[model samples]
Target chain A: MADPFLLAATALVALALGLGLARFLRGPRALDRVVAFDGLTIVSVAAIALAGLVTGRAIYLDVALVYALLSFLGVIVAARYLEGGEQ
Target chain B: MSGVLDILGGLLMVGGAAFLALGGLGLWRMPDTYTRIQAGTKATTLGTLLTLAGIGMIEPGWALKLALIVLFLMFTNPLSSQVMARAAHRAGVPLTPQSRGDALADDEGRAAE
Candidate 1:
């Protein structure tokens, strides 16, 4: 890419994604996996946003917005499922 | 002026990405679920916000949409974290062995008093 800063940013976000994935795989508890998943999705959203910036395309940001909303909903629903009737 | 903006935006994006990496490190290294949640939620939220802001500076015309994403994230990120934490607490996900008391559990005890 022409932008070294953004290129580095992409690498860092990719590193984050890898770490989150490792945690998701190594989790001893369901909650840990959920937390890892939450972090992973957020990183993915950031990645999408970075892609938008790098490509100079506003449309990617729209995709990012929808992704963020859906991930939030997914996390909430998963948490609620795990909470069961204890709430 | 545009050059300066580009430089500043690049710096912000780099900083934000660094924060995102730190959050992932925390997720990998933290001993327990709650601490991991704290690390994952707070750091990534800030990182995402800073990143989006940098993108906005680089492309001013996209500011409104970027702001919408930022606002939505600010509202939902912590809320989802809170929900997850509460769920984990109720589901009996134990804390780290060396950790202090849980205020949420204490609140429950006090409520019964």
Candidate 2:
């Protein structure tokens, strides 16, 4: 496939995922894992968009765009639960 | 002609990727939750933005897509960081031993008083 874009994007994604795994494994606390998850979301967005570029399909871009918002919202909702949980 | 643009765009995107890697390393290396968040937030934000912009440069059709992604990120990234920080504080995560006053702690203390 003549899609260096996708290849490069995937490499970056893998790197981010690797980092996420590291965070999950060695994280000092729950919040560290959560922070890594946030990073994963961002990487996923970039990866999906790059995939679209590789495939010559504009659809993936939209997915990336939508996912970014959804993941962000998800993080906020999770945060609220976390913050109020002690109460 | 367009080759130079491609090279620049590729460099920008790849450089961003490297920054992302560095940020991730920082996340793993940093000893505390707050510091990890800071590392992840600063580097990943800039890296992702650069990657998105690079894609936009190479693929004109991706302009709107990149723009939309960038827009949502601008709004959400900081807010998410705030949310995570607040959660970390509420969960009673121990701050680094050498920390100064924590505003959230002060506020909560006053609220309880």
lDDT of 2 by residue, A1-87 (tens): 224644665687678768867886776566677787787787777777667767778888878877887888887877777675443
Q: What would the TM-scores of all predictions be? A: 0.92, 0.86
Q: Which stretches of candidate 1 lie over 4 Å from their true place?
A: A85-87, B106-113
Candidate 1: lDDT of A70? 93
* All DockQ scores: 0.70, 0.54
The true-versus-predicted C-alpha distance at residue A85 of model 1, in Å, is 8.3
- Output the lDDT of residue A30, model 2: 60
Q: Candidate 2 at residue B73, lDDT?
A: 87
Q: lDDT tens string, model 1, B5-61? A: 888888888888889999999999998888999997779989988887887778889
lDDT of 1: 0.86
Reference-based TM-score, model 2: 0.86
Looking at model 2 chain A, which ten-residue stretch has the lowest summed lDDT?
A1-10
